[model samples]
Target: MTVIHNLGFPRIGKQRELKRAVEAYWAGELPQGALLQTGKELRSRHWALQKAAGLDLIPVGDFAWYDQILEWTCLLGAVPARFEHAATADVDLDTLFRMARGRAPQGKPAAACEMTKWFDTNYHYIVPEIQPNQSFRLARTALLEQIAEAVEAGYNVKPVIPGPLTWLWLAKGEAYTQGATDAAKLDLLPALLPVYQDVLARIQALGIEWVQIDEPILAVDLPAVWRDAFKGVYSSLQQGSLKVLLATYFDGLRDNVSVLNGLPVEGVHIDAVRAPEQIAAVRAQLSAEQVLSVGIINGRNIWRTDLDKVAQLLKPLKAELGDKLWIAPSCSLLHVPVDVEGEEGLDAELFSWLSFATQKLDELQWLRALVDNKVDATVEAALEAQRKALKTRAESPRTHNPTVAEKVGKLTTLQRDRAPFSERIAAQQARLNLPAFPTTTIGSFPQTQDIRKLRRDWRSGALSDTAYEKEIRAEIERVIRFQEDIDLDVLVHGEAERNDMVEYFGELLGGFAFTQNGWVQSYGSRCVKPPIIFGDVLRVMPMTVAWSQYAQSLTTRPVKGMLTGPVTMLQWSFVRDDQSRADTCRQLALALRDEVHDLEAAGVKIIQIDEPAIREGLPLRKADWDAYLQWAVDCFRISTSNIENDTQIHTHMCYSEFNDIIEAIAAMDADVITIETSRSNMELLEAFENFHYPNDIGPGVYDIHSPNIPDQAWMVELMRKAAKRLPAERLWVNPDCGLKTRGWPETTEALKTMVAAAKELRQA
Candidate 1:
């Protein structure tokens, strides 16, 4: 019989109990003990669910207070010099909170670790800081405690964690990160391996049989040194009595499969759903005695599995390998919502075609029974349900719109090409003469509690449409006055009427679905409910024109028409898998193109099409980058071009490295581009040092993600660094990203200081 197990599960409660508890703890209302108790309760509940699902080995150490990578940071005792942790009986929860949030209970703030997307997923993890000669000790005992907690509950558990090579590979020191010499970090592997050995020793003492050591980096194009280091790292693990299951996901091992040819590991898990072609190559490397776990379920999106197709594929493998074959998800279920059974009022047909974390578990169980040729009544029902859902989705007429398809087909280079940058900039300057280092914001402003309540009341029908519009207009007026008072050169309506950048548009557009509660964690306690794009995307009327018109009517200052770009709307949402992603994105681009035309007609001077996920949507392998980048750039251009030369199109990208895709970015041809660089202190300017980017650039003056405010001098200094790379006239002063999650006071002060810094730059 084939074994069924999960790599991990979503830690946040279905209703976001962990986010509420942790946020309350940060606000000083809930005590640390109470917050910890909530975690324990959630863990117990989750572990019990996994056991009831009939998993062969329940996953432990998958629960995290903040992030799994940061959890490992504490476990390795790799605390940076700025942070000071205390000793606790269990774990230093306070210190862990401080490192993630940058505040230590009433004390001075330490700079939080740099955060970035986790390997093409929307989830964010705190990047580990590894300095030169960084030594390690067992700093955290939470993993061990969780293991014991699961064992005491009478469940056989497999402890999952990042391997030493991946941890060091992801760190940000001299040799720790990519594009650097791996020799330095590889040399420290000798010191790090003993820590792993010690950790495995404690886990082995718990009577656990296998440790799922994840090495997702092997899926990427890795340096040769890092590839060589994995062998020695796992080879040393042979000293322990426990068996190790080396897991890699998101992509195949590619050439990295050769390194594991004769490794000492007992099992290897491959993401067959993503890279099934490499299964034969990987199976060739494994010995007959070793177990091979095939991740056959789709873990990234919320789509139901095709049971018959999967059974056909796995049955042959099951016959070849027999009981040695294992079935699991392509990756952890952390990227998806917890359960779809609880979701109500969504489209009934779409619901049938959906599968959340809990539902995926059911699919995995049925897969096992199907492969074993033991179709009991329960498994048969599941198989039938899966078959019905797959059939309905395949033949649904709602998935296609002839008009939208015609529009997308008609789009060409003429629709994408704009006026030359030199001519367009001169026209823009002639229409609206501004300062050398002008000040502006990315798009949104602070979305305060009152603003959230107003939206809630409107949605619940407690507030009439007239009243809602009145209140939103009042808020826009206040925002306009605030920007004017702060002397920001360009202004936005603060997006007070919007709920989310993507969801607001989805609500007004065709071929989209919304859920009552479909939350996925974006970063630390912050969660995003992504829209479901199930059909052709077409906005019937304008999405942002009304709001932009109202805001512009309130002030003479240039008010931006804020819109989430085609790529971001497609990348961030649970996009339909029926068509090619490139086609769906092109459809979205054609739809948004109509909005750009309307916004320009409404007298909105500058329109921002936010494509922060462009880099996030890049293919994992370099060989596939050009094809993806071509469509991505074309989609952005189709959405942004064909405007008046003086309309001044702008785009914003945040928290992603641009050195690799700089040319594709330039090809988008926006009049101005703003990017997040404050977290790295203008370090991202290196992208511009080589590439002669023609258009204007704004390398964000301050990071808007953090609550810590930088003064005018700090903003001036950052702008000065940017000024060195490009001419003063080409530099715009703006915050790193939107201020949706921030409080009003901080947003006000930050903008005031930013405007003052722009003045200083102008004077210089």
Candidate 2:
């Protein structure tokens, strides 16, 4: 019989129980025991759900209180020196949270481990810090305990771990040698492999039959040395009694397929959803004894799976490999929401075309039944319904927009400003009449508990529309007054009316559907529900004009009309898969262009269209970047270009390695650009300096992601470092990103210090 399995499942409960529990613990409302219990319960529920769904091999060791990577770091005894003393089991939660979020418990300050994107996805992982004399031991018990828990529950479980090669590849710092390259970090893999070996031995001792070792780095362009290292590491690992299934996803294993095939593992899982063309090639290289786990359902997206197509793809494999064939998702269901069934008030038509994690698992189970010739009448009806929904969505007039398509097709050079950078800067300065070293925020203010409650009440019909508008207006007025009191040069409306930058706009636009429980973790305790764009994106009316006008009415100081940029809107959302991403992005850009024209018409002088996901959307391989960047840059320009020169277009990007894409960034040609630099200590400014970037720039003066506030002197010092590379006149001061996640007390104090620091720099 063919095995049906899932790579992993979302740990956040149907109603986001984990997020609430984690936040409560951070706020001192919940105890450590409570938090741990919540994690245990979530893991238990997820495991049971997979088993009840009829999956043959449910995965364990994928749950984490913070991040799976951070868990792996602690498991390997690679805790950085700062938290080394607290690495004991008694204080493990404290140490792990510190590494993930940085802590100031009882006034004792500890900096967080560095965080970056997990591949191209919005999910972030804590970067492992290693020293020159790093060592590894199997010190943590979470993975083993989870595996044991699942086994005790009477279910067949496959323990999952980041493979040795991918673990070392994702790690940072020159641990084994001084000034080592990322490839050289693999030298520590020798010390790391023993720990993994011990882990496998322990799992084997528990009578675990299979272990899923994830080596997602196989999807990337790897160094020959790293490819060679995979063999040595797996050779040591495969010697254990536990059968190893090497998993790769997120992209095709093109040239790396040969290297993966040569490994002596019992099974190999390839992402057929991402690269179906490579399936035949992968099958040719597989041995008869090796289980071929084919990923048929898309794990990252939200669309309903086409069962007919998947059945066709898997039928030939079943005939050739019989019991050796396995069915799975393209990757972990961690990227998607829990269940689409829980969603209320979604358009019935769109809902029928969507599938969250639970629905996807059902799809996987149905596909297996079809392949095994075990389909019943109920299963046949479900498949038929799926086919009808797919056909309806494809032919639906709701998805087509003749006007939007015509507009995109008739694009011209008018999509760029007529004036050069120098001229445009002069024009903007003349209109706005701001100070040197001006101060402004990226976009939003804190979305506090009270604000969230008000929005929730409004959504649930507990609060009237009149009452909600009154509250939102009051919040906007308060923000404007606070910005004036701080003596900031420019101000933002604080975006109190919005939930997420992308989702807020998506809700107002055509061709989008949102979920009530479609939450995915962006980082520790930060969850986002990415809206689904099912068709051609169109701006039916103005999205941000009312709030922008209200904000401007309260202040003589220029208030930026905050909008999420086209690239970010497309990148952050669950976009349509039928069309090219570039085409979808262009359609979004046109929609945003209409919004920009509306904001400009409302007399909003400064508009900050945030493109934080621009760098995040770049292809993993460098060779594929130029084409992606061309369209991405074009989309950004198309969004902001319709406005006048004096309109002062500003864009914000955060948590990216901007040096590699500085040229493409400059090509976007915003009047001003703000970036996240405080975490890197203004190191990103070097790119602007090297390129002699002429436009105004804001190298963030404070790391808004952290709760610890920077003193005025600290902010001044960072400004001085930025000054070394940027002309003071061209400098703007801002926080790393939106202040949406922060408390009011911290946000107020941080902005006060920031404003004071900018004034100090102006005097200097």
What's each prediction's clash count?
A: 0, 0
lDDT of 1 by residue, 1-764 (tens): 68999999999989999999998888899988899899999999999998899898999988999999999999888776677554332237777776787864554577677888888888888888887677787878989999999999999899999978778777885445643444777767777888888899999999999899999988888878878777777889874669899999999999899878888899999999889898889999999989999999999999998878888988888999988899999999998999987677687898999998999998888888888998999789878989999899999999999999778767763556878999999999888788899889988888888999999999999999999999999999998998998888998899998888999999999999988778888888998889999988887887788889989998877888899999999989999988899999988888898999999988887889999999999978898899999999998988876789999999999999898889999999999999988877787888876798889998898777777888899889888888888888899999989999888888988888898889888888
**Each model's TM-score?**
0.98, 0.96
Candidate 2 — worst ten consecutive residues by lDDT sum? 173-182
> What is the lDDT of every predicted structure here?
0.87, 0.86
Clashes of 1: 0
**Tens digit of lDDT per residue, candidate 2, span 29-115?**
988788889998998899888999889998998798889989999888787776654454433667778777777233244667777
